[model samples]
Target: MLDFFIQPFFEFAFMKRALVACFALALGSAPIGVILMLRRMSLFGEAMSHAILPGAATGFLIAGFSLPAISIGGVIAGLVVVLAAGAATRATDQREDASVAAFYLIALALGVALISMRGSSVDVMHILFGSVLAVDEAALLLLGVVSSVSLALLAALYRPLLLDGFDPDFLRSLRGTGGGTLYHLIFLGLVVVNLVAAFQALGTLMAVGLMMLPAVTARFWARSLPGMMAVAALIAAVSGYAGLLLSFHANLPSGPAIVLACGAFYILSLFFGRVQGILLRLLPTRHLEA
Candidate 1:
C-alpha cells in the first residue's frame, strides 16, 4: 500500500515533476475557478483555453517548442480574444457569451490550421492533449510564477471581485474611481495567464478541466466564497494526485486521467456533499426555534 501510493513520486523524476505541476495548477486555477463559477462565466474559461491555442501554435511555428515563445504567444492571443469579446459586447447587441463563443470557434480553427501547416499530426496531438510526464524545468518555473501572481492578485482584488459578481450595478458605479474596469481587466488577465500555464501541463483541451471541475464540486459543499475556494483547491489537489497515480499504473494519458479524477469528485459531491448533495436534500430538515 505504501509503495502503491508513494513509490511513483520517489522512484521517478517525471512523476515528481508532474505532481508539482498539478499542485501548482490546483493552487492557482482552482480559486479562479470558484470566481468563474460565481460570475456564471464557467464556459468562458473553456473558450479562453481554445483562444490561446493559435498563439501557442504560432509560437511553435516560429520557434519550435520554446516555452517562452509559446507562453508569450499564448498570452497575447488569449488576451486579444478576451479584449475583442469585451469590445464586441460593448459595441454591439451581441452578448458577451455569444461574442466569446464566436471568437473561440474561429480561433480554434485557425490554431489547428496553423499547426497543420508546419507540424505533423503528432505535434498537433502533443499541443492539444499534452504530455504531463514530459514537463521540464522551464514549464515548472512558469507554473510557479503564474500561480504566485494569481494568488497575489486574487487577494488584492477579493472584495471588488465579489462585488462584481454579486452586485454589478454597484461595481459599475465605482468605474470612475478606478475600481470596476481595472479590476475587471486584471481578473480577465489572470484568467488568461492561468490558462496559459495550465496549457503547458494539461494541453489546450483539458486545461479548463483542472480549473472548473473542482470549483463545480466545491459548490455543492460550500456556501461561502472563501469556503468554496478552499474546498475547490483541496479537491483539485486530491484529483491531481490520484490522477497521476492512475496514469502511472494503468498506462493512461495524464491529462485525461487528472480530469477524470476531478469528474469523479464532482459526481461524489453531487450525491454526498454536506451543503447541497442529493442525499442531504433527500433527508428531512429539522426546524429550529427562534
Candidate 2:
C-alpha cells in the first residue's frame, strides 16, 4: 500500500516534475489567492485569468507551444485588462466591477476567436486545459522564475498591500512615502505573473481554481491573515499531491483532477471545518448559537 502511494512518483520522472511545479504554484499563487479573497477580488482575479487566454492563444499561433512566449503574452494581456479596468473605473462614473466585467468579456471573446483560427477542438482543449503531466524542463524553469519573482515582490509589498486591500484610506494616507504606489504596481504585477505561471500547468479555468479554492477553504478555519495564507498554501500543496495521485491511479486529466480535489476540500471545509463550518453552526447543543 505504501508502495502504491510512493512508487508512482518515484518510478515516473513526469510525476516528479508535476509535484515540483504544483508545489511552486502553491507557494506562490496561493498567497496571492489569499489576499484576493481578503480583498473580495475573486471576480477580478477570474477575469484576469480569462484575459490570459487571448495572449496565450496568440502565443500558440506564433510559436507553437513555446512556454515563455505564451507566459509573456498571458502576462501582457492580463496586465492590459487590469490597467484598462483601473483607468476606466477612475475615469467614468461606472463601478469598477462593471468596467472589469466588460473588459474581461472582450478579452475572453478575443481569446476564443484567436484559438478558433489555428487549432482543432483537441488542440484548443489542450491550450485551455493544459497537460500537467507533460511538464518539461523549460516549463519548470518558467514556473520557478515566475514563482520566485512573485514571492519576492509579495514579500516586499506585504505591509502596504495588506493596508491597501483591507483599508485603502490608510494605505493612501501613507502614499507620501511611495509604498502605496509600489504596492499597487507590484500587487498587480504579481497577479499577472502568478496567473501566467498557474495557467501553464492548470489551464485557464483550472488555474483560477488553484488560486481561489484553497483561499476560500482556508477562510473556514483561519482567523488571522497570515494564518489564512499559510492554510491556503498548505491546502493547495496537498490538493496538488492528492490530485496527482488520483490521476495516476484513475487515469483522469491532471488539471481537472487537481481542481476537483480543491473543490472537495472546499466542500469538506464548508461542512466540517472547525472554525465556521456549517455542521458546527447547525449543532443546537453548542453554547455559541446566535
Model 2, 1-290: lDDT tens digits are: 89888898899999999999999999888889999988888887888889888999999899978887898899899989988988998899989889989998999899989988988898788877887898999889988888898778877778888898878788777675466766777787888888888888888877888898999999998898889989999999999999999999999999999999999999999999878899987877646555
lDDT (Cα, 0-100) at 285 in candidate 1: 80
RMSD of each: 1.5, 1.8
Top candidate when judged by lDDT against the true structure: 1
Count the clashes in each prediction: 0, 0
Per-residue lDDT tens digits for candidate 1, residues 1-290, read 99999999999999999999999999999999999988999999999999999999999999999899999999999999999999999899999999999999999999999999999999999999888889999999999999999999899889989998899778888766577778888999999999999999899999999999999999988899999999999999999999999999999999999999999999999999988799988888878711
Q: How well does candidate 1 score on lDDT at residue 78?
A: 99
Off by over 4 Å in 1: 174-178, 288-290
Q: In TM-score terms, which candidate is top? A: 1
| Candidate 2: residue 232 Cα off by (Å) | 0.5
| lDDT (C-alpha) at residue 269 in model 1 | 90
